[model samples]
Target: METWKEPQTIILWIIIVALFVIILLTSIIFLVRTIFKKIIKAKEKEAAIQLDYQKNLLETTIKTQEIERHRIAADIHDGLIGKLTALKMQQEITSKDQKTIDALHESITVARRISHDLSPPLVEFTKLPELIKELLDPWEQHLLITTIFDIRAEINDTEEFKVQITRLIQEIITNTIKHAEATQMYLHLKQTENYMALYISDNGKGYDVAKNSKGLGTKNIETRVQFLKGVYKVKSKIGKGTSNMFLFKN
Candidate 1:
């Protein structure tokens, strides 16, 4: 009976040890699962935050663009137009002699050219490539600028995208000459995979875009890209030059 009692005690101790091991393993597994859930929750929260930030940024950018467009329109209508009207009034008041009239007429022609250059009919009539070439003509000799025009000949046949693309190219080229200090620039237009890509790269002193103010230049490019339903990428680093790449899908 004592021997039987001793074996029973040993069996009970073995059972207790096995139960403790099982309990320890279960606790460890639960802890690991809880840690994994916490990690997942944190990642989800971060993603949500990033999405919200992007949405807000896009909204603010749209508002800023509208304001700028209004300002530019006002400048064209009220400012430049007013100046031209004043000039015409002066001409009317002056003598009607042939020499005087001829000089006035030439003056008027120059004024008209300036006005047209500032706010061109290309915005409504000409194709994008032609407009870009027209804008770059003055700077060509000064900057040693060379163009690789890959613009589709039939692109202007469609009214929808032509105007927007022209505006985008004008802004890009203007900025490249004024700010990039680039000696040579390249413009490439191509279509692939149901998308059109415009690549403009310049060899110049690059800028720190992240730290720089995202002013009218950057905003204008961004707005044009958005209006065209395109993706835009600007890449630049100090001493390495800059590239503005735009991809549009039809």
Candidate 2:
């Protein structure tokens, strides 16, 4: 009887040890999984915070840029415009050449237009389609290139949206005319179910866009798109020309 009791006691101790080991392993596994989940959540939170920071920074920068533009326009109108006017006034005395005087007059007119462009337009009071047409007028007589426009989207009343879209078009066309030397260009703006789409294409000398990825014009366009919470894609080839598409959510 004494030997039987000893063996039973040994069996009970073995069972107890096995149960303890199983509980310990389960706890360890649960602790490892919890820690992994916390790590993943932390990383996701950090990314969200960073994205918010970028959005806020972009908004402030755009507002500051508008203010600077206004100041520059005022300076040009007050100083450069005045000087150009004075030059035209002295045209007769400086030279009797009507051609020179006419040239000076044209310069003054161009300067005034530049100053006006530097200031924000009354987008709320104007037709966006008309404004865009006016913007394209300068390129109409570019004997080198034919410009086409297809506008099917009504203007968004939001001030920021209007200004950014208009400026985007202006800047892109300016880049194309000044750099691309393309023979043809098309500007298309359309509205879809969820957003407005802008498509610009030019047939000209495309560049190594990857090499000059951080170019001023490219950065400016990218920043503007980001400000509007939009996306843009640019495609270009050395001789095949370039096409850029932008989508702005409604």
Backbone steric clashes in candidate 2, count: 0
lDDT of 1 by residue, 1-250 (tens): 6764798888998899999999999999999999999999999999999977876776576557545654665575567656656665676677545665566566655555454454555465776667667766755765666667664434433444664566677687778778888887777777544667788888888899897648787887786677566899989988888888998875
In order of appearance, the predictions have TM-scores of 0.58, 0.81
Weakest lDDT window of 10 consecutive positions for candidate 2: 143-152
Which digits, one per residue and each the tens of the lDDT, describe model 2 over residues 1-250? 6764798888998899999999999999999999999999999999999988988898999999988987998898899889877887788787777998898888887877776667645666766565667667766776243444454555455766777777788788778878888878877777644677778888888988889778888889999988888999999999988899998777
* Candidate models: Cα lDDT each: 0.71, 0.79
**Best lDDT goes to which candidate?**
2
**Clashes (N, CA, C under 3 Å) per candidate:** 0, 0
Worst 10 residues of 1 by lDDT: 151-160
Off by over 4 Å in 1: 1-16, 92-141, 149-175, 178-180, 203-243, 248-250
Error of 1 at 144 (Å): 4.2
For model 2, state the Cα shift of residue 54 in Å. Answer: 1.8
